[model samples]
Target chain A: MTAAALPRTTVDRRPPLGGFSLTYLALEIRRVLRNRRSLFFILIMPAVFFLLFGLPQKGQNIDQANSAAAIAYIMISLAVYGAMTASTATGGAVAVERAQGWSRQLRLTPLRPPAYVATKVLSALSLSLLSVLVEFVVGSIGGVRMPAHVWLLAGLGAWLGSLVFAALGLFVGYLAPAENVMQFMGPILALLALFGGLFVPLEVLPHVMRTIAKFTPVYGVGSIARSPLTHDFSWVAVLNVVGWTAFFGLGAALLFRRDTARV
Target chain B: MRTDTLAASETTGTRTPAVLLRGLTKKFGAVTAVNQLDLRIEPGEVVAFLGPNGAGKTTTIDMMLGLARPTQGSVEVYGLAPTEAINQGRIAAVMQTGGLLKDVSVAEIVRMTASFFANTRPVDEVLERAGIADIADRRVAKCSGGQQQRLRFALALLPDPDLMVLDEPTTGMDVEGRRDFWNAIRTDAQAGRTVLFATHYLEEADAYADRIVLIRKGQVVADGTASEVKALAAGRQVRATLPGADEVRLAALPGVDRAEVRGETVLLHTNDSDGVARYLLTQTTARDLEITSRNLEDAFLALTSGEDTDLEGVSR
Candidate 1:
């Protein structure tokens, strides 16, 4: 290690997009994709639930719609659940990265903090999309027959609505210890799914449970997703998704700044 | 844009110091981790920050790398804020530990780090230079501590930074690993890139650093070349064979800083070895008297130990 030339490479200062790069996002995605256990939970678990619950309801039709409508509703609910789980897991993984000091390592690089956050969101969104598509494919195989536009709109709604969970995941990741983050999130998500009417329809439930479900973040997502098929579009669902996104996004940003600002 | 700033400054022919910290203070609740510390490093100097555990070495390094912010004062890297300097790829760091991802292969992490910098050395070259090319395929979780450290070094090298700040860079390495790592760092330092490394190892500071900054209790107690720091804690030890020697009385004697009875022989640490030698030989039936100048270890203890906690006129 002697007589080596100085490292005098020309500086390429491209700060547009705040040092964001697809190469890094690809690597981040690749790491999660390689985790077979997580993939099972994010992609396979929802499909399993859909098969378990939706198959029994395959021959039934409610409100005089097609028999496939009941199965499609279950598929959409599972899709929302799967997409949220995928994104939240990806976002919540930040706690582990923080615990390992990888976050500190990244701060030393040219990658800005905003770029890191953006990469994480993109990475989570990618996995969320995959989770949603996996359910859709399974739904199609299981005789879920919706019009082409409903499939696209419902899939798009489920995938896009998952941005709220992505932010929630990041917030929880930064808030909770790495070991306890998923443990805390798992039960909370299940409860949210139940209260949001993703598990059982609000119609069958008592009046009080139905009233309280509307306030949960998951209810808004479920309404937006089911609106395309049910034709029951409401501005309240949009408010719920947008409001929770801002709330969790703000919380995550504050926690992130605090985490990086101290030892 | 940062390159343009650098090129402009170069044309003016006044080289900016690689790092400049002025009255830097960091407080975590009631504990003041770094207390108004000031340091300046010019380009090409390999300086060592020597301190014991909990002596604010990590905190100071954290502030310099923009991983933590200072509560008071300022840190400038090449005349820019720490984050700005880092964003410009003018500075990089090889932190003590836990920086590499466990599931990722060594090569993959290196490639990922290289992507963060718009201008970086080739990934393979950095891997080879850090001497981790052979283990590049191994997952970080499977790699040994030394291998992980080398991988961290490789990531730092990706940007080809002008200033490298390392916090205990050779912590988990073996003897030979430490030697090889320092050899690589020395080669880099010789090429006019400034390096500041924090370490608790006295020998690392003695052997590698052009200057040593000895810190204790969140303040610098001694700062100079290896020999200069040794000279700062100037003293000598006088040894004599005395049966049933009273260590307390000997320590109370004029010019005797400390005295210890080591079985048959009594060792007296003192500034005035002549006085200690005269007292031991004449006042007692002592024989086989010998005196020696203090080494760096003795100097380290003399300056760093004790509760004086005075912070004035100590630094060079």
Candidate 2:
């Protein structure tokens, strides 16, 4: 009506590809950051628990020679715990979205389909990395310090752990019916993480349970993460962790895409 | 099916249609949600699509909005393929659920969605237009159902799109809310946007739409102005109290299609019962006669009444 600026309609028709990517990323980050509960899950609860659990058990609890080595093992094992947290959070979120038709709404939007899976996995990775970073700082203050190399190893293990469980979480998110998402997701992750040695070391498991754990993805993630702490850096364990992550991620993505075709 | 012939047919007073769908069919597995359907909508017009539950109105809207693909035929919005054009940011739709993100506020939702269009209406003006300005700060999840509908209206108005398609926009709204919502739509139509709406409330369409199109079993059975459609519902009915009325003679009269004699009341159904009543008054000793014409409800019932609707295949 008055002397004015250019209207936004045509201006919005095409932003650069990067801008669209960032928009999708921003929307996801914004939603996750808005709730106090997600903040607690993302920052406080994991970091505090990792510190409380990692300090006292740093050296004497593991029978390892050096405190650095024992601390690394604990840090690596905690990656599995981080993965479990992501799985539970994301699984619950997706199931809630399904119930409230939020997933259907997202499907209708112009957001690229692959971006949905990619964004959640990456967000979970970033969060777990932050959690492990906090745990390392706390471990240092609590009379456990590692060489710079071990710190770098902890970051990598944390990210890899995030991917493995995020993919698992995505699968469970889709497969569980909306009503029982909590009931199913919690027990499944708890049992798998326990057997993978987050709550109990693999050395303490019974013979049958210990053997069965070798085939599980949690075992793959935990063993790889633990190798970083022990400075073992087993190539086979690393490959197994990465391989299962890709397999689960792809399977979950295809399932998500197929279910949304109607939506 | 020929566009040129249809265009030729279009130019002889009706003008080129704003939308045309020829044999629009969409099937998911074995369910043919939108069967082969042919439909045309014109510019500066409002059309209401009416059908029973699971009658494929939402499926048809989905195809038209380019959310889903057609299995057998094609759909065009203003002569452009719906999918490609909508992705390019042309037509705008207000869907069920309002398509509003729960975490975002009403203002943020409008601002983000409006960024997708060029020559978009101003954000503040759209806020006022959708009547959500008072609670623009409210999260979409926190708004009342009707306020949520208005926020969606704001989003649809952002692009100032040539065509606006709404599917069950007023489903969970209160009466005044529906009124305010349609009032905003009427303003959009006044701005020359072609408005297409789907509703189970026959009266909503009757009040706002310039024309009503009723679909049954995935096909268009009636499409015309309200009165014209009403006239097609076996037209009007005329009942007369005639003194020993000659039922056979009246049944045989011009323009009178059917007649029933019930005691003193002689009932006549015709395409033009008014004319029939005039003729009857002059020709017989009919004491008291009442004539009534079909309304949109009657027209809707008449068209959908014949189709086989099992409501089996459509999901919600």
Query: DockQ numbers for every candidate?
Result: 0.39, 0.21
lDDT of 2 by residue, B1-316 (tens): 2223222244445444557788989777888777898887765567788887777999998888777778878888766676554655556788877356777888877766654333457889999988889898889889998898888778777756667888899988898988988898887677677788998788887888877776777766566666655765546889889868788988887767788898888999876777888887887778678988877676677766753442111111
- Model 1 lDDT vs. the true structure? 0.83
Q: Worst ten-residue run, lDDT, model 1 chain A?
A: A1-10
**TM-score of chain A, every prediction, order shown:** 0.91, 0.80
> In order, what fnat does every candidate score?
0.58, 0.13
True lDDT of residue A98, candidate 2: 69
On the 0 to 100 scale, the lDDT of residue B104 in model 2 is 81
lDDT of 1 by residue, A193-255 (tens): 898889888788899988998988899998899889888889999998899999999999999
- CAPRI-style quality class for the chain A–B interface of candidate 2: incorrect
In the predicted model 2, the residue pairs found to clash are A9-B117, A9-B118, A9-B119, A9-B120, A10-B118, A10-B119
Give the top-scoring candidate (TM-score): 2
TM-score of 1: 0.84
lDDT (C-alpha) at residue A5 in model 1: 25
